[model samples]
Target: MRESFYRYLMTKRDPNGIDEISHFANAAFFDQAFPKHSDDYHEISHYLELNATYLPSMSVFDEAWQGYLEEVI
Candidate 1:
């Protein structure tokens, strides 16, 4: 999922972003980023806060990912 999101972001958000994405993206961020709707949002934002060079918030990541899903689905 991380790889998917990374690729999505690379093409959509930051075209000039790095090609290498962290391997732990799925384990570290995916689940949190896409949880069920709740009044209190749990940042689900990328957990790789330290490694995120271009992608900023979960909202941004989610948008790119949703677009990617729409294309592939």
Candidate 2:
């Protein structure tokens, strides 16, 4: 699930543009945190809350999570 989410995030990155920096940064952080092996939203949210100091706001995560759900669910 983590791998899928990471790929989902990466897919948001613009190939010839710079509009998706947040997605790139979040993907990097997600890779580093190596978040739990669960797909539960709350569990991932808790993990991010605990370890995502680099994130400016949880809204970024929330956005990515929404997109991920749309893509995979």
Top model number, lDDT? 2
For model 2, the stretches where C-alpha displacement exceeds 4 angstroms are: 1-3, 13-31
The CA-based lDDT of model 1 is what?
0.40
Model 1, span 1-73: residue lDDT tens: 2334444433442334442233223333444443323212133242335444444454555554456567744
lDDT by residue (12-72, candidate 2, tens digit) is 6654555444544545545666453456778777877887665567887788788888877
- Give the Å error, residue 8, model 2: 2.2
Return the top candidate by TM-score. 2
Root-mean-square deviation per candidate: 8.8, 3.5
Clash pairs, model 2 backbone = none
Query: How do the predictions measure up, each by TM-score?
Result: 0.36, 0.63
Error of 1 at 42 (Å): 14
